[model samples]
Target: MRRLMKLGAFALVLGLLWSCQDSNEGQQPQLEEVPDEVLAQVANLGFNADEVKMYDGVLFIEGDIRITLDQLEKMSPSDGLPVEEHYHTDNLVTGTPRTINVYVQNMPQKYVDATDIAIDRYNDESLNLTFNRVSSSGQADITIRASPWYYYWFGILGSAGFPENGDPYGTILMTRGYYDNVSNINGLATTIAHEMGHCIGFRHTDYMDRSYSCGGSPDDEGDGGVGANHIPGTPTGPSANSWMLACGSPEGDRPFTADDKTALGYVY
Candidate 1:
């Protein structure tokens, strides 16, 4: 009788677990269909169109390049070098010598100060493109905001949007959890600067090889047109101190390396 009772209890728990699984499966959201043009644009970027999907009104391609529905409609596809060929975007920020206003979303004063430091770094470069801090989101070209705790699971400090179709470039999403955990001011500043590189159409310096930072099989991002465009004058080999490296360390507070300056100068 004791053995029978134990088996019965185990069966009951199993049944409850199965029921919960079914309930959760029923709650799963369905993916929204994307427009053919949007798919085509993604293909032009060297991503597979079939892999494209819309969720929560945002279009995700190649596991990155978040685009809002409105931004999708406005995107103009252009032919460019693939991830293997280049590291800069064909869709660069318009208006030569334009001032890009950056706004920091309401957060800790440290984040705001960090952003200011990043801005100073760029402004000091004396490049044609300029960065300025703005108090209002309405007046800003790029809005820097914090991400929820869940974002830390991706193991990235921050992410940024690329410039598309004359849209106000893209947003910078900084992981608050990562920042709070690491109190390195220069490292945080480097993180902000790295994302800013993405906003201005720069890809990872080691776009072809993420092993140095990400520690995985070398990723070409995609062969052919989907890969990153190699900037002229930048070294073909990997750069250890590039501010645009995909991953960052708490101790790695990289200012712009010589190669980084050359690439930025050549493009912007």
Candidate 2:
């Protein structure tokens, strides 16, 4: 009788294992379909159909390019030939002498000061592009806000949206804890400036070869019929001093290099 009881216990354990496996198989998640409009926009920007994927409601293209459905809907149609490795959205803010009013919200005093310093750097150049601080969020053209927690799982410093269809570019989102933990104030300021470059439609200087700054294999975002454009007069190779470099060093403080100024002058 004891021998029979041991065999019965083993059989019951095997039955439970099979039940769990069946449950897991039934619970498998399905892939969400990419919206037609979103796919068209991505294709227009040069991404192939296979390169674009929709997962968990977020659209991923070229591996690193993350877009929301709302943002995809807001983008304007693409135009112009690829120019310097600097990437840009087809949508540019209107008016030659554009006055972009920036509203700072929810950031600590230090970050606000850092943002002001960054704005001053651009204004000091006396280019056609100008950024002014405004007290009211409703009256502002660009809104800068700090995230309560780190949102970029990849350790990115910050991110900004591009100018789209008549919208005042997009909001700038900065990582709160990352900035708070940094000892160098200038490096923090550089991060703000880099994201600002994106706000104005500037892609990373090392967009073609991220290894220049990121120190890894050359990261080709992807081969879209439309790749990064080369701004007239900008260098063809890697630039160390560019404010728009993809990676930043905690000890490094970067101002606009000559090429960066040239690119800015050419665009704005």
Candidate 3:
């Protein structure tokens, strides 16, 4: 039956991802969580271990998510103040020291291409960014995989990268395949930049907190602040022109805003 076949396919995908789903089901490993010392080591890289712990742990991500257009419409853009362009490498934080790669297993090639282009646009010339297979001793930046979910979506919500260890190391990305059926994939670049921004210790430019001196609606301002945290002139654009804005809005400009550069300089 078609239902049975679908279940079989789902199992197959899970097997490939975990390699030991059956044998290791419910068998939690006894590896140590990131320690304070480890966090201190990457303090300059961005990301706080304590904060990351809120989301860290074995995750059962259903790469096969199904979000309806109505659901998409329901999701609101984050409400927070934009991050001021004042990234301090000294203030960076982290948990463990590891790198991850992203892949879009069943996603379309066009989405993949779009992500690559976004990376090219954001990375400075000195970065010389490129994607390749991850290796233990080679270049294992991050590995992204395309999802098999008919309705694929990505965001900080399900991503474990934020609450992860290391000095806000990078996370590679890919898209789910079936959604690839549709066209006009304009959001891919915005998605990548948004996610990558998290990896580099940049929070949502519009993260809001009422208790702070920069008071306003909580999370009303985006993570990137007025001019963006970049070197002067390098990340030219309106503070609001970043690609990492809330959903439903047209994509932000391609170039990195000042906040973006300041964050990058903090880590790299």
Give the C-alpha lDDT of model 2.
0.58
TM-score of each: 0.71, 0.72, 0.44
Candidate 2 TM-score versus the reference = 0.72
Which candidate model has the greater TM-score, 2 or 3? 2
lDDT string, candidate 2, 1-268, tens digits? 0000111123333333222111333333444787777777776654434445555666644322346777666544344322222444345666758788888887777777877878998898888879888888987887878632213232223446555554445677665544565566777778777667666665556656656766656665333555455666777667766887656564467878887887777767
lDDT of each: 0.60, 0.58, 0.35
The residue-by-residue lDDT of candidate 1 on 1-268, one tens digit each, is: 0000111123333333231111333333556788787776665555435445566677754333456777655544343422321356556777777899999997688878878888898888898888999999999889988753323332223456666654445588765544554476777777777677767766666555655555656655443353355678777766767886655464457888878887777777
Q: Which portions of model 1 show Cα errors greater than 4 Å?
A: 1-44, 47-65, 68-89, 148-157, 226-230
For each predicted model, how many residue pairs clash, with residues at least 3 apart or on different chains?
12, 6, 55
**Candidate 1 residue-wise lDDT at 197:** 71
Give the per-residue lDDT of model 3 (tens digit) for 1-268: 0000112123334333332112323433332354555444222222122222211222211111122223223222231212323332222334323223434333446756755665565544233233333324234454444422211211212231332223433443332332232244445555555555544444433233311222323323322222234444333322444443322221223356555555454444
Q: List the residue pairs that clash in candidate 2.
A: 46-224, 83-229, 83-230, 84-229, 84-230, 84-231
